[model samples]
Target: MSGLKLEQVVKRYGATQVIHGVDLTIEDGEFCVFVGPSGCGKSTLLRMVAGLEDTSDGKISIGGRDVTRLDPAERGVAMVFQTYALYPHMTVAENMGFGLKMTGHPKAEVKAKVDEAARVLKLGDYLDRKPKALSGGQRQRVAIGRAIVRGPEVFLFDEPLSNLDAELRVEMRVEIARLHQEIGATMIYVTHDQVEAMTLADKIVVLRAGRVEQVGAPLDLYNDPDNRFVAGFIGSPAMNFFDGTLHKGGLRVPGLGDVTMAAPRNAAGAVTVGLRPNHLFLAEGDSHVVELSEQLGGVSYHYLKASDGTKLIVEAHDQSAPKPGSRTGLRIDPAKAFFFNAENGLRLR
Candidate 1:
């Protein structure tokens, strides 16, 4: 229900700094996700926002109140961790109301809040059941319900669906999305899964080595990345990168049968060319060898190795798949290609 802000937030351990000076703003009711690879400090940043970790130097504010020095209990934020830390001895209803009960809320008020949370999480039927008696998804929902009863200003999720099976993960993702829609509360989620960020977030913050890589909508980052890391990290299967030489008239790529294509404006010397799997297709002559083909019902992924030993992946929607070791050619869509400076990996406009 309240917006959150961080100004020059920083975290350090002795001589090593894990979180660099970061500035961010989350509008009220916006669902923001932090995504990156392991050891990128995404979880650490989230924990700092929750007041579970101390900030080495910086300022954090929630709903116009500075909470950088406050304890976790006073931050007006509820965190749902990766593990469902439910009490086995207590029933679903009791667990959901325990916080309020311990805080001196009356029995009738606690009961009403617990009931409302159960109804919102669709756990009304399992109120009397213990954590051991419920399924994994049910237990997770109970944990979420516990948070819901507190009525926090912001919700923090730290890979809450990591323990569930694939099917259950998908199911819980839909459930969480619906929960956000109904409650309309500001949420900050941390995960290493870009797919989750793509599906769940209104805005995504991509991190690398404790530095902010990019911050934008999921598709915005995917479609137009500022650097090579963001471009490579945002898409599934990753984008194929090739070494190219920019000449007077065009760019020459040795991996693509030494093909020459139109170069971008102001680009010169050595450059990197990037192409997505869906933008490259199997063509007529043999310039590459098929390594493997993965058929996934609706689409197939063809893994190929060019004569220069460069690897590439092509996504094909048709049912036919070429056999391994078969020689083939590739056709890349010029309009969809991306050019980057080879030395620094910055996009060339």
Candidate 2:
């Protein structure tokens, strides 16, 4: 029952308010991720839950116990930060057991806990190595092992993989995912990397300007977004958009031409058409011209612009991807099209 709940959470610094009233519930053993662009208050909200930042107004409960006013150590939560934060001179085992030692745990008990964590994190072979002797991923693992030795009810990670190289980031992502699956603990991870959010989270909390935009499972948010922001932010290449206005049965995009949308006619004023890059395909009509092609081995992405100059991206795996400045027709299944209100950037559904 180590779930977490936040009710009407708010944070303010003098007259400037951040982290608006946000209500969320993360069930026990759920891997929840907080993701958004920089300065979007994702980290701030996570810090608040960790008792590192004060909540201006709200109630925070972990395992049903109110912890908004409790000190960090008293809240029974362990946090792993972006920085490794390990003791430079101490061995891995010593670093992992330091907290328990400081709290006066018996040496044997500390060693036992440290040994268990090392086993879990696959750090048994490097237990005697100092922080300086480990690779970036290994150091981060040691940091995670340090947290595991504490046996906290919940684990908080703040951009734990931001420092790693691309390949290492992917490696560590899998490692963390496996760790969560093996331990089945309640975990909250924060990152600006959408790939990390998509792959690691059982659920995602997308924030903006200190307010929550959407919260749902990764693919749920990807396939069904609440707004333009959520649709655009959750994917890798991102969802493509074009400014349009309601016409007879669809919206008329100046550059993309007329597109039949599923939005209610009564809800229309100025509208936007959202087409995922993966959904667009090459057709035979002269609708667009290829602007650029990004080829990455087996897959390629063709950046195109309509005759009217509305830009779009099409995901193509064909080796003979369209060349730059080549004319081509693009089409999408009518059922897959997404519409948003141009004024508020909200989904038209």
Candidate 3:
């Protein structure tokens, strides 16, 4: 059982506390990701798990073995950092085998491990080349290969694709996913980009303000968010929120007029209505004006604003669409709508 477990983990830097009472579990061979905004302590938590940072409190166990006080070398974990801190002067083969060589492995043994890692990473052709000769994606693969050669029980990646170009990042995402399927090693990855979190993780831990907010599969988090923050942060272009006053017959929105809605149990007064951009559609009537249109080949996103200045994004699939600045009516499927409490941002349903 090479799984990871954390119990009431906390990290404090002098008088300020950064990570607070975090408890989590990463199952063996699971690809888990820690995602959040800057200064949210996602990286700090990952570093603590790596044994790079000391645990101020609480227990950490890997494979059911207590490793809270263990040094990084003794923890059976390998980390791939964001920066490709390769030795420019060393060939790919040498770079991959350097750690094993230093640890006094026989030359033949080191060579075998390096060779296998190279083959796994598709870096066999580049083994003789220096780091300077490789492209961004290749260098990253070399970094991963370096970690693989260590034969660690778990792999930790700290935003390893942040430095790559957009196209290369996508390419490397596929490479990493394939590597995980082939090796089936327990993995922990940290990143602020939700898109990366969505695409790469088998499980995602969403953190905010040094505390974990939610945990689930990617689509689970998207389709069934616990609160407004999780809903807004997990989706691209974000979920649109409109404030309104609830009445017996309908909800009164400031800019868009009253919308008839079935009231929830004990629901009344101030409230917030949540609508995903994809759920909104064009209708006949002139209640809203188009602000802009973003056409991305096959699909388009129309930005609209009501007379009272409430903004919305409506995703339109057809090429023939309303022109910018045109007035139109909008309709939402009530079944697709999400309701949230205006006071605390918690999902009402």
Candidate 4:
């Protein structure tokens, strides 16, 4: 269990810069997840930490040692990739012990380490089997077990669950979480899936276009995003954003309706109003849900369109859902509304 730190990290290919200057720190035994869209340079950042990709400029330190120019093996980190890179012909035990064997570890020591990892990963029953004989999840576990046998100071996962089916992904996610708790190893996981980031991370680092957007607890990012982008990216259905103008003591969603809030201390001009679908409630007196839908379940979503076609997604977990053309009332607690500058997308207090 070691801490990792990046200081003004940058990566460039030729003259094209991919990773902007980034600074972050992961505490010892922390599970930090890196999340962003494709081409966002998340994998590039992870690779740099692994010593697989050189940093264009800046410093990387692991366990208080500067490893900026060290080789991957010298960095004391083990990586698990999306593809299970187990040797096809080797048996599970052989594959798990291969690294130690190559490193000149004694035969007995290698066997003991491999056996311990197998037991920890529940692969003891499949030690003699080859990768071909194991399920997708089991193969991934073997890949992880191989890392564990090496006894690394930190674990780096690059979308390790991306290749699995949805159900298996969930199962493996729990497995990884348990591994972290049991082993207490510092881990840095990269993924584009927000759900994965939210579910698995002790802290999440949200990136955009190679720059750090926000780094915080999952619920912190969901409930108090620093900008409109962060707010929309961290949630399930995503927070609803609409063009609106700041008024005397509130904001107005043109065509749909207006919500008056406690006067913003220092607010003005045009702004974007945000509503999380889970927060939008169907009420009779003040709330107006313009459109509704029932997805053949107890929890149905309502898609309300303003006269100007501005859309809002509302969740009606119970009660009857309205038809597409039918109208329903909606209530938005002004305090629950998020306001961002329309032009800059920055939050307004």
Candidate 5:
């Protein structure tokens, strides 16, 4: 296991820059996840670390070794991509030991390593089965086992679960998390799913448009985001935003029945008020109309539209669900509200 560091890491294609200067550090044995929307350069940046994409500028180091210009094989990193990319003709054991065999490792040595990897991944029973005979999740485990046999310093996973079905995705997530804990390897995972990021990462690096938006533990980012984008992107169902005017006295938001509340210190003028779905509750009165309601057993989601046409979603824990087109009111928790500058989207301290 080893730590990885990126100093002003950058990537470009001709004159078009896809990744800007990004500085980050992943401590040894940390499960770090790079999360962002599509086209945000998360994959591009991961490719750079793998030495598969040229770093237009900047430095990348793994285990205290400068590998900025090193070849992919020399970078001491094993990558598990979105595709399984396993050999259909080879048995699971052969597929997992292929890398070592190609490098002239003795047959016995390769078998031992493959055996250990299979044990760790719970694929011992499937060793003799070919890729065609394995399920999607098992095939992916074979792919991961292949990487493990190489014993690289770092593991890079680029949306490794995207191809799996919903149930398989969840199953694979637990498998990967367990693998990380058992091996204690330094792993960098890239994904657009915030739920995955929140559940899997020890630390998450949130990116946007090739720049670092924020980096912190999942719950830290969710509870205290530095800007509007991070706040919206880090949480599931996303945070709800309301346009409000901040004055010396308080803040007024028409979307919440023209509600007024105390403003943060030194905040004034046009600001965006953010509230999580769970923070907002349904109440009596007809300030808004329920556009839709989703009941998922233990919890329900109410989609509402204010009289002024502002849309919002409220999460409720009860079984009661309002009917569509029904009049309703929203209750906001002032203490849980977040304020950001409307123009710049920066948090108001």
Candidate 6:
């Protein structure tokens, strides 16, 4: 296990600075996930840590050693790419042990390490098979096993499950989590998928426009986002936001009435009211109803619009949502609402 620290890390391609100064501390044996939308520099930051991309400024330390300029191989970290970069000509065993071979380890030692990794990853059954004969999930396991045999201080995954089918991705996600627990190795994973980050990370780093927006546990980020960007980004249906003003101790929605709700700490001035889809409930005396309804078997979603045209989405277990164009009342949970500054998008009480 190893702890990783990035102090004011920056990455720039000529004058275009992609990753802004990012300072992060990943604890030993913790599974940290870097997540954001495309071009947000999540992958570039990961590559910087893996030494695939050079740091434009600041320092990167793994296990207390400054390795900001070290080569990928010299950093004592192994990276598993999204493509499952396996050598087609080599069998699973050879592929897993390739690094050991490349480093000129003894044949017997390499064989032992490969066998151990195979057993751990359940790749023993496919030792002699090439990448073509393996399923997507199995191929990914081979990729992970390849990293496992390296015995690196840290494991870096770059959207390692992106190529798999939905079901396969879920399975691999669980497998990766289990592997992290069993090995207790420090892992840094980069993905655009919030579900993956929510499930696998001990800490999630939410990024936007080359800057770190927030870093917290999954539920911490979900329940207490630092800004409007984070509040909207962390949730599934996403937190709903519309133009609203703060009035004394309450909030006023443009198309809706003055909502008597507590604001998040430090909230004042012109602020946007933030509420999650799940936080809004169908109420008896409300004035929003179904503009559209989508029923996905066990769960139903109602896309609603207030009398003045404010859109709201509600996810409910109620399988019988009103049909499109039907009017319904909705209630907001006062305590669950968040308020953000209109100017900078930061949370305010």
User: Best candidate per TM-score, number?
Assistant: 5
Higher-lDDT candidate among 5 and 6?
5
lDDT, candidate 5, 80-105, per-residue tens: 99999999889999999999999999
Residue-level lDDT of model 1, residues 175-223, one tens digit each, is 9999999999999999898989999999999999888989999999999
lDDT, candidate 5, at 240: 95
Candidate 5: pairs in clash: none
Model 6 TM-score, all chains together: 0.95
Instruction: Write the residue-wise lDDT of candidate 3 on 1-349 in tens digits.
Output: 2899999999999999999999999999999999988989999999999999999999999999999999999999999999999999999999999989999999999999999999899998999999999999999999999999999989999999999999999999999999999999999999888998899899999999989899999999999999888988998878888887777577776544456677556555677888889898888989899888888978889899987788989887878678888998988887887778888888887
For each candidate in turn, the TM-score is 0.98, 0.97, 0.97, 0.94, 0.99, 0.95
Worst 10-residue stretch by lDDT in candidate 1?
A: 248-257
TM-score for candidate 3 = 0.97
Computed on alpha carbons, the lDDT of every model, listed in order, comes to 0.93, 0.91, 0.90, 0.88, 0.94, 0.89
Listed per candidate, the RMSD to the true structure in angstroms reads: 1.0, 1.4, 1.4, 2.1, 0.8, 1.8
Q: What does the lDDT read for residue 293 in candidate 1?
A: 98
**Residue 183's C-alpha lDDT in candidate 5?**
98
Instruction: Write model 4 residue lDDT over 1-349, tens digit each, in one string.
Output: 7999999999989999999999999999999999988988899999999999989999999999999999999999999999999999999999999999999999999999999888888899999999999999999999999999999999999999999999999999999999999899999999999999999999999999999999999999998999998999999888988787666656567634554455345567877778898877866642343565756487777778766667788876786766677565667767688888888899988
Better by TM-score, candidate 5 or 2? 5
Displacement of the residue 171 alpha carbon in candidate 4, Å: 0.5
Quote the lDDT for 137 in model 4: 98
Q: Write the per-residue lDDT of candidate 2 for residues 99-198, one digit (tens) a residue.
A: 9999999999999999999998999999999999999999999999989999999999999999999999999999999999999999999999999999
Cα lDDT for residue 73, model 4?
A: 98
